[model samples]
Target: MKTPVKSLISGLAPVLVLAIAALALPAAQAQTAAPAASAAPAGAKKIIRYAFRIAETSFDPAQITDLYSRTVAAGIYDAPYEWSFLAKPMQMRPATAAALPEISDDFKTFTIRIKPGIYFADDPAFKGQKRELTAEDYVYSLKRHYDPRWKSGNLYILENAKILGLSELRKKLIAEKKPFDYDTPVEGLKALDRYTFQIKLAEPAPRFISSNFTDGSFTGALAREVVEFYGDKIGEHPVGTGPYRLAQWKRSSRIVLARNPNFREVYYNETAPEGNARLQAIATKLKGQRLPMVDEVHISIIEENQPRWLAFLNEEHDLMEEMPADFAGSVIPNNQLAPIYAKRGMQMVRYPRADVAVSYFGMENPVVGGYEPHKVALRRAISLAVDVDREIRLVRRGQAIPSQGPIAPETSAYNPKLKTVMSDYSLAQAKALLDLHGYVDKNGDGWRDQPDGSPLVLQYATQPDQQSRQLIEQWNRNMKAINIKIEFSAAKWPENLKSSRAGKLMMWGVGWSGGPDSDTFLALGYGPNKGQANHARFDLPAFNKLYEQQRGMPDGPERFAVMADAARLMVAYMPYKVHVHRIFTDIAQPWVVGYHRNIFVRDFWKYVDVDLEAFSRSKGAAQ
Candidate 1:
């Protein structure tokens, strides 16, 4: 599935760092000579400052696997392979329909034909020598992910015993005590030539095209020479073939990115027709048509909420993703902020699914390592014990919808015919099921237990958030009715994610992206993914068969039938109890241009032509 863009910078109260380039330009020349100040010569370029959320954790794509790293990494790196986001959501069905038709075709094995003339970013530490990106770069990148020394979080994404030899390679590397080789020859990845790359999957993956677009998950082409010389500072000053290079990072304060003069042109063509009014207005902004409309994107890191909103309103930051709802509704409406809003605007976006925000509840299946007993009826009762509807209304203010299966309703993969395990707030039924499963409190200590007087308690870990706390409280209250108590502990994202992966967690909130394709998010059923708790360690042979079948079937009646069966089986088993899929929300000032109204906000910065000169003048007048 597609990874959501992480790190939305707050626009509240940002302390502006005057760009060196901006400060150097004469004030009068900037205001009166807009063309001179804003325009880029045939070869020269202009820079646009954008507000990015997280500064970034790791520059190394292999080691970095989160929202914060993925979005920024995209610019720095180039993929010989890339996915095309279709205009229609949920159109990426298996067999019958591939991803975008323009993407590489499968010829026994998938191979991507690269567009020529592309080059990687120069290694600043290496005398700024530019290296041509080649198919070998992809091989090196994948090897980095599988390298044990690198310990990349995404190692499992492309594991191949035949190609990567992860099991054998790691074994030998441990014995030899050598640095993980980036060029470890594996059958899964091969360079047809300098420009063509062939990626071999263990099996034909219907969602491979969409999966390639995700950051951190898929391997990106890297310059070998760059990695060799600057192996130590690679994460600090990463090099790639992105539109913008990391110029400066002022940790938790600001990051400045300059235009990559040698960067490739716009990746995708999203041009609207000339007759379209939106296109006409957008076209007029480009007085001097350059491919990438924005020149310099300056990201300021403001963690405090109030300041971020204030900055956006005052026109300090162009755009702010993850804007607080209260600020989005109340502040931007002010006429005093009219001019700031005049230049740019905000957009509402959601994935294929609506209302459903997926929340993961740990299931005790021991295959991966779950210790919980295998009781199908007990799992059903647990689902019956928790009222997802009430939780949605109370905890989420009815902002979300109750979901029973992994596939969100908005996705075409969702099977509506499946029977939902709706908990009707019936504590008696839950107690009856527990009794039927032979669990009761013989000593009457205000808690249920095994026949041998063992206490039945579920210890759940959750993030330190008000919403999570409230959900735990609700679950605790309902569990009391069945004389069962659950212990709640608050942990950070890393710990929760780690424990969940180990299948040691009892319950936690998990958000997954359900892209246009069904198989994209089907990793839940993969054998290796089991026991890493993953909320549910369900090893249903039937579900696995259906999942594998759905991947090969075309997008039609038969595919839908199999997908529906899978969804029904998942809901019936109650492997993971879900509540909602936390959608990404953002608010931007009107002057912050090029914001899209779609779920996938790719190329949002391409057409935006912000009037930074106006903001400069406003600041000058205020001073």
Candidate 2:
């Protein structure tokens, strides 16, 4: 968690501000000398610019659910613990805490300590005084989720987190018809002192630290006075003790973050790896560098693929994330970097994503969500009708692997051998199921009809993007084989997400990454998650029971058994058609150094530096 890293930085404060010792690589792994003029910036400060595939809607961590917004929030806030920057197998280190939490009472009690002297960015909420960060701030921020007015998307995780008195306090607030008294102390989430915070849970949960608390969005420290100062407009102005501060924001256009002048002095200290030839080369150039090497960050939205690619090619954007599916073949032909980009010294990074992309059928909608025998049959028939193999092969351009279930490949709980129903191509079997349910064309209209002679039409909500269109085309082709007619309801991603969360959409497709925890992967089908994470609104007591069973258990064979059962049940219900696990790619110019992909962390502009000399030359030549 961020706590250990926090301790490391705090301890290393003496040496962090000093000049860095030049990293030296031996003859074998050494980098060649760069063109002298392109080695360092002339006189100007360096700024790193990139693009988000879509615009973020909010900066408030509690309200942000989508990945784009999470990326934005991560830069402005620090999680209690951050993932180890260079640890293989992905380890957690404290980012802002003094140490790893001390657990007592058989894991039910957690006590955390924070180092002193850290301060938030300059804000009027401090009333002309520096607002030193303390343990109480985290307590107030965590309690904000249960205030009932925030309508936090993260409420389920907080409420069900089994925090000893937190849930009871929410119930008390509702019963008394009183607004949540933030002043009234909740014993379960209390600050023991100015620097020590204690949390008591209802049960033993050893892995809860990595699952719920490690979520960068879930653990960012928020100050109460700042919230009160902004009130309804808090999202517009974010103040945190992170490495960067929100400087300028134009909704749907651009966002700029400036390095915090008061940020703690920290250098790059990582667990040294050995024997990996590629990592050795990268380490030779960056081992002792100071962190947050850049001065400012500029992020813009470019929704279309063509313009985004062209901008990267024109040396306008520093990084091109997610090579378009249409161009994957041409860009990285035969799994090799194309000569055109290689000639310019562009670096390509590709790795398996920690998430799975899926399409869900609304379990409450009359056309799809239902429990009757006929309704169940229709859903299963449609699931079988989807040719997921074709989607992975054609739409993904072989950049993905067929999903076994909701659990992603990155998780230890993923079972490659788990049999997923309707995952294979079987049009004949799909037709058989439909025919048995009495689905036939009553008016010779060349499409299936409901048993009661009503037209069965599927209305799906989709984003207006080239990739989504390709996926829809594959789905339509598969449905056509069964003579089922479907239509599209197009909208922006934000609108589609809003409609889905409200249970207004009959069907919609999305992606989710549960990180290292299988509980998150299984909890998507939990009954209480309806209108939140259970986008399908699928509520089965049997499934929720299993979800709880797995949630309480730590990782082991017993937990794996429960996870497998939950996945099997989800496959049987067929609320979602999970097709692929993607291998995302990013191409960065030669001037962008120290670019590496972490499966969990997405916002890493600070960890990267712009080789000013090279970047300046590239820009000048482009003009």
Candidate 3:
């Protein structure tokens, strides 16, 4: 079996090198020792500063779906399991759990034992007493998804698993228009003891634990007292047992976190994969030190690429998470760090991220949405008109590979040998399809009209950023080639996400990042996922059946076959145009230590450190 990393490298080897290489340094610069800690005053705080490309919506695990919000929530919450900080071929380890989960032979039942003595950050919700984390917290946290009040974007994942008795309770509450009862125990989710919880599913879920429970940003435990106390404002006031706590939040402008004084003692002990000299060096230098070596983290939201890049160049930020595609040529030309940055001792980590950027059409819209043959033809024609290769080469600056299907590059379901019409660009075929479907310029206008002689204009929701404008320009050119009229609706990312979830947008383009399991990408077309992850609202019964069938089967030929069928259905129906799987490059300053880009791990703040003395000296030298 080919690993995700190997598969990614094999797919992009011709155009790019997929290794996570730390740029080499000159001998003179490499031998210079880091400044000693004694150069700084005693008890001085170590702070790591960075910027996010988009604004985060909420800190609550259930309410957030965007990457930025989840990244912040991962630091504040503790899930049952997490990916090892330094492990390659990513390995899952216990986070709040005492050990790995105990599962039944059939894979339907799961039981986890929580570690005792874990305490949430001090909050008034506990009434002046320290509140220790319990298994019941996990139980309540999972139940929140089924509650109609939160409208969780992740509810579909849990619902598809068919947890025993939980869905029924949610249905009953919905029918009665009553509030969810967290105290009422369901057969599927239960607290067996003070520090143990058990969950029973209606069907076998082979990858459920790793897919859902491993990421703290999505499945972290929550306190009942905290939820009831804060009510609708729970997103702003996050209290958890993780290594960091939310100290201040300025909405989209800024966010700050402080180390949890009562956090449990966790040492920097991780096994690095053999033969990767970069990871081995990091492990050797930071071994035996305490986790979350920094005292504070400062995050600024700078949506534009130019300013964010300039901030890092000016040393105002210590790390740049995702190097903007617009500056890729100047920053890392030909997949190698440029001399300007390499001379400054800046480090670059580059890898093919496990994600797909796509444009989805709302399946319920009147003009472009329907199950009829004509409507399907209209969608397929539009898909064929998009020049994916041109977008990747010009707009993305040759930093991405054309996506052949919904499955991202780094997943078991992703077949490198598979080729489909999803990435094809043929203006001639698109025009023929539109003519056959009655999309014609009936009144002698330059643009095409609907079959009923109505204006056929595509309203696409977009953000007001430089990248988005570039993408819109691509769309305009592509649509004009086929004589189709199109318009853009500009809004902030959060506003656009809200409208998309509510099914108010006619079309939108977004990206989805995969987790440890492959089923996550397929969930986009699952019928049950329609108001949540399925932004297109595609309710095809055939696709939904295949999605359910694969969830129960173990990792083998049978599951792979089912996933391929589902992916084919998505391509045929043409609800989404999966454009590309992006390659990301993150750069860090010389003062930043132990920084790495792990696709499966979002809670990485705890694994990194900062050289306070060196940072101070750099600031002085800059002045």
Best by lDDT: 3
Scored against the true structure, residue 231 in model 3 reaches a CA lDDT of 93
Q: Considering summed lDDT, which 10 consecutive residues are worst modelled in model 3?
A: 1-10
Candidate 2 per-residue C-alpha lDDT over 1-623 given as tens digits, one digit per residue, 9 for 90 to 100 = 11000000011121221211111112111223332234454567778877777887777777777777777778777767777655677787777788887878477788888888888888888898888889988888888888887878888876666897888888898999999887787777899999889888887777767666555566788899999999978878888888889999998889999988877777766554777666556666776777688889888887777667667766678888877655666678776777656766789988887677778889999888887778888888888888777776677777888776777787878876766674666789889989999898999989999999999999988877777777778878878899999999889888888888899999888887766666766667888988777888989888888888877776799988988888888887877877778777889988998887776775687777888877765554443
TM-score of each: 0.77, 0.91, 0.93
For model 1, where is the 10-residue window of minimal lDDT?
90-99
* Candidate 2 off by > 4 Å: 1-43, 272-274, 620-623
| Each prediction's number of clashing residue pairs | 39, 13, 0
Question: What TM-score does prediction 1 earn?
Answer: 0.77
Q: Say which prediction, candidate 1 or candidate 3, comes out ahead on TM-score.
A: 3
In TM-score terms, which candidate is top? 3
Error of 2 at 288 (Å): 2.7
* Candidate 3 structure quality by residue, lDDT tens digits, 1-623: 00111001111121222121222233224444543223666788888899887777788888887788888888889899988877877788898999999999999999999999999999999999989999999999999998989988788789888999999999998899899888787899999999999999999998888888986778898899999999999999999888899999999899999999878889899889999899999999999999889998999988766667667776789898878776676669998888767877799999888788889999999988888999999999998999999998888888899988899877787898889999999999999999998999988989999999999999998877777788889999999999999999999777887788889999998888877567878888887777787889999999999988898999988899999999999999988888889998999998888988888887677888988787766654443
Angstrom error of the Cα, residue 499, model 2: value is 1.1
List ranges where model 3 is wrong by over 4 Å. Answer: 1-38
Local distance difference test, per candidate? 0.54, 0.76, 0.84
